[model samples]
Target: MQRKGPDRRALETPRAAGLAGVVFALLLAATIVLMRLGIPEGVEAVGAGGFTDSARRDAVRAALALIPFAGIFFLWFLGAVRAHVGDVEDRFLATVLLGSGLVFTATMFGAAAAATAVLAVAHPAGSAPSLTAWDFGRHLAYTLMTDYAMRMAAVFVSSMSVIGKRMGVLPRWLTAVGAVTALLLLFVSSNVPWAELVFPAWSLLLSAHILLVSGRRRRVTLT
Candidate 1:
């Protein structure tokens, strides 16, 4: 009897997905950093002079441009993880992972839209946004990004960690890291400035692990 070869498509999918996850993490982290630098959280409202800093406006625009691509790569990353998990995945955990990932993406998009609205309102020459509109947009963007999106990311991380642990696909240290990241996102992100960066950091680590594992598997298959 001849030995069967590993499925090439199956071998490639996880690697590609891992790469997408890496890209997503970088883009998202950059977007967040740019937004933070460009829009500094404490601005209650534009003064009577109006917010007309061209440099900040350009930074915001750059952040906005990265968002869609980040979202797309995130979706690919999600699909890849799910595919790697395959049919043996627990239905409950899978549902949580999928739901949280999707909700996080949507919330992120909402935040970006709010940020874009802020930019649009300030774009007209010497036209200052009313205090009410400025405050509303600012609060809405932060709340969506730091509160809702981060919470959903916490859920996603916790669920994925549980799933990976149960399946023995992830190392103990990775699982521990995921748990800690989830806890931080859940309890600390909204209160602490820039804490949401943890999510992308964890994603980067996980993606790197996945890529490493995929490479080892490919080598084993080849041998």
Candidate 2:
């Protein structure tokens, strides 16, 4: 009886992860373009207290569409990570890491939707759309404060570092950077709001690294 070899699917995981990364990148790009067009006008109107009700509705709708893309990207991103880091330690760590990341990602959307729903109820139908500065501030804050931040901190600080070291995909330096970024995010949650933004940016970089490594088609070697 002959022993079975490693499944062909295992070899394809890297390529699949790379393709997913490309898709995720495109999604983020689209979301960013839409956001640039939507959020500024929306926030400006809210700040000036002059946005008409219809305009507010349209802007909110646009912004809402953009928000979901981030969630989708984050979720798919974890899938890509797990797909590439094909080892015991990497899998276990990625399981916890992805689980936490998704939890945070889901909560971010949940909170955003909740806030939007509350605002819709408060504003009601056909009422004057006079948004106060406080409303705008609160809305911005609501978008940022979430499990997304915590999970990012956890993943960047711990899981990615472990994956990077174990899999040898990303440079050790980048993994170290991820660890530092994660720690900064955890400690600077309130004082430095930048951590929230930094975490995702780092993730995108790491994702790009994974994509680069995986993009080339592998030559099969039966050993």
Candidate 3:
């Protein structure tokens, strides 16, 4: 007796597309939040002397808030693309591409969380030129270069927007932005204050397109 394979046709639906779009929006929003308030891990307000211990603690709180969402967004982004355009392209390659993006996102989240937690706990209070304070500062610097900085580079270079266009899920212009944004990340991530602006800005554009395009398609079907 021969067994039947799974029904592939049943997997396709407008509902799936809509859900995927929503997930993408969520991922974009989470990334934006993480960018502005998440990674710095310390130094909240510019202290009188510059960067007090309290400021550092605030940064840690922001980073912690972003950790779960970062991971969730990676997984969610994968599912969204898989649902939206899987049938139109090489599923395996597309999955690998998405997995690459997710890997970078996850790496950033983990590193940020670890770095923030360390800084939060080890932060020096008041004016201390003690051994511990120096060590903590060194730790912060290391994490900045290794975790946040590197991850930003990876996200920019990976350029899922390119893949989305090739797969017929997004416009070429959008992918171009992804490409430009990815490239910009390398040079600008250090600017913390400004680097934080990229994700929200990108998200708003993409989310608006998703909603508008998806809605227009729905109307055409009804007519």
Return the top candidate by TM-score.
1
Give the Å shift of residue 122 in candidate 2: 6.9
Q: Go through the candidates in order and give each one's C-alpha lDDT.
A: 0.89, 0.56, 0.52
Sorted on TM-score, highest at the top, how do the candidates line up? 1, 2, 3
Clashes of 1: 0
Better of 2 and 3 by lDDT: 2
In model 3, the clashing pairs are: 42-56, 43-55, 43-56, 44-55, 156-182
Model 2 lDDT per residue over 1-223, tens place = 1332445565566556555555554554454343333333233535533333455456556656766776776666666567656455545776777767776666656655644553454354545334553365345534554234455546535776777787666687788888877776666644543335555556656666665654443433342
- Superposed on all Cα atoms, the candidates' RMSDs to the truth, in angstroms, are 2.1, 4.9, 6.0
lDDT of 2 at 40: 39
Residues 147-189, candidate 3: write the lDDT tens digits.
Answer: 4644554463344575567757678788777776665565555
- Candidate 3 global lDDT: 0.52
Cα-lDDT of candidate 2 = 0.56
List candidate 1 segments past 4 Å from native. 1-6, 43-50
Better of 1 and 2 by lDDT: 1
